[model samples]
Target: MTFGGLPTRWEPTGESRGVALVAPGRAYSPAAPLLEFSRRALLQHGFTVQQLWWDSTTRGEDEEPEQWVRRHVEAAHAEEEADHVLVVGKSLGTRAASYAAERGLDAIWLTPLLVDPVLAEGIAANAGRQLLVGGLVDELWDSAIARELSDNGCDVLEIADADHSMGTDDAVRTAEIHLEVARAVEAFLSQI
Candidate 1:
């Protein structure tokens, strides 16, 4: 099934023991820069990446982000039952990940949009089994929500001294942040 938008490229390696679905942020495509970074990072951790683009009706014609994700996830499951699906999302994509969690899918949230109570409930529901990464400085997630997530069982990892992007404008700093994200995901995926 096409799931509306562009289908994500699945790079398979013999070492890959599981499948990961990369959900894009907002109206963005699965191949967007941030998603690509996460995809490569997952590959490093030995997961075959399935980049799923959310066709956002809110952002464009006939592109409802929520519907797109649900469809993609169902399609993914039909194609191959993932040992665990690591749902990585940006701003809007974060919301989509939460929905996936409610359906009992394992996830890895990057800079999740915690303002939404639904998202929190999803994270709380999947706590230690899934890793939740957020910036120390992202206003999108408030302290109370953070506490709730931790209280509910989410493994909250704060990116210290970083903003929403988790890195300064310097190339070296960005790479460092990416590497850090990669390591965290790899460690978490390894444990699962």
Candidate 2:
């Protein structure tokens, strides 16, 4: 499907309780493990998932990275008719945090760039519930900032020894980490 002139993959459930707008990281497509499992979790919870794809090559010369991300996310969100909306983003995709905050939408941010002042402030300003997941080894993640956001009422999951991809050297442990994230997502969905 196409939303806001961008190619998107829409998965509709029989009886959806809400709509999940999934924004992928620059390198991480919707098919990536973290996003793919998260989409599955949303589907299990009765949400119609609309997964967006970004083409950086199409970005305008004068547009900043954050502006480009916000443009696409806003476009997709504008097309949603559901009252309950959830924004699930990762890495570059997490740039949409401000949009979610302004719209008072719930969100799940995976490996968010906690270093970006604008994004950090946006997450802190979110009016609805939020779940923030990040690996301790990720350079973009700041433990202090994550804790601060947690204190502001956002649920946080910090994985030990995991990298930006939420993976460790051991394949078994990486798989377990993935499962753990999925379970966390499920639990969060249950609450809100």
Candidate 3:
């Protein structure tokens, strides 16, 4: 799929009933290793997957990341005829996905960015379920963020001893995070 003069990173998968759309973190490319893990995790649980790379470099200076995400989502859903779209985003990408969900797309946001009001408004607007993967022990996140999300009706899933990335650079923790996401996806898909 394509958006705003930039080429989107989309992969066709064999699974039916669900499709995953992942947005990479800031300064991260579409080819980042995390995408592979996300793809495999979803595929393992029977979901077709697609990735959309949304970074500062890909959007216009005044453009909202959520708007960009929505465009990509519309194109992907139309082209692929996907039954449901699960949005897996990291950092700023999370912000974008949450906002897109608010705009009335059926999605499950993974590790969504909860800091920005613009993004938060969209998330609140969505009225859809969310999955939080942040570490409970990390200093970066406190109870307030979690409370705010829950207050806004997001279903928070805290990962103990994980960081903002939800995994150590080590292989074992990375695998664990991937597994957690897979389980969350399964649960979310089952509900819908």
TM-score winner among the candidates? 2
In candidate 1, position 100 carries an lDDT of 67
Clashing pairs in 1: 56-63, 57-63, 57-64, 127-153, 127-154
lDDT of 1 by residue, 96-155 (tens): 654666667677777787877767776776533666777767777666787667677666
lDDT of each: 0.67, 0.91, 0.62
* Model 1, global lDDT: 0.67
How many clashing pairs per prediction, in order?
Answer: 5, 0, 0
The candidate that wins on lDDT is 2
C-alpha root-mean-square deviation, candidate 3: 4.4
lDDT of 3: 0.62
Ranking by TM-score: 2, 1, 3
How do the residues 1-192 of candidate 2 rate in per-residue lDDT, one tens digit apiece? 874665555565687899999998988888899998998899888898999887667878999878898998899888888999999998999999999999999999999999999999999999999999999999999999999999999999999888999999999999999998999999999999
Q: What is the TM-score of each candidate against the true structure?
A: 0.75, 0.94, 0.69
Residue 85, model 3: lDDT of: 62
Clashing pairs in 3: none
Error of 3 at 65 (Å): 3.8
